[model samples]
Target: MMPCYSGYTKSGDKFFICGKLGPHCADARCMDVGTILCDYPVGDGKTCDMPICESHAFEAAPNVHYCPGHALMWRKFVDAGGVERDLKNVVPFAAKERT
Candidate 1:
């Protein structure tokens, strides 16, 4: 599993994404195995945190994340040979693609 998650939200079944300070997701459906994806409506605002929650909310700047501790643990999991089920390299593949 990824140390963190990335996606939007759903109100009826997709409300919105709430970063580390995450919102209530016990209601959303499981879009991904071992993970949850949701969506929500964006509100009108004018501040630094505004873009963080765009109207489209399509900003894929890492939808969600694990706490620092979990992030570290996840790193160890991969380094110690944890299975990577994602198509993209858990370690990143852009480098190889660029070559």
Candidate 2:
């Protein structure tokens, strides 16, 4: 990820879409119509990513518009091996492309 990020750094902070979806992460990077905005990857550990710590999404209107991107920043944070440890290991972030 840092490799892609380094290239981006030279280009300035333009928006670049990144996702761990499909094979490596089996992540569904995009949403479809009728996806129910509040839906947060509901399924088994293989198919879905939501942890048991969360409650089901709301059924009513208004707040249900949030997608997982807008939800908690758990996946990447966890993948980075937790924030405190990441800093202690103390290396610059890497671009996955470079690796």
Point to the candidate with the largest TM-score: 1
* Per-residue lDDT of model 2, residues 1-99, tens digit only: 621111123345433433532222112432211223344445563223332111222322354332345345445665667867767888788778765
What is candidate 1's lDDT per residue for 23-48, written digit by digit as tens?
32232332212232322222463222
* Candidates' C-alpha lDDT: 0.36, 0.36
Q: Candidate 1: lDDT of 39?
A: 26
Per-residue error (Å), model 1, residue 72: 0.7
lDDT of 1: 0.36
**Model 2 C-alpha lDDT versus the unseen true structure:** 0.36
Model 1 segments more than 4 A misplaced: 1-62, 85-99
Which stretches of model 2 miss by more than 4 angstroms?
1-67, 83-99
Provide TM-scores for the models: 0.23, 0.17
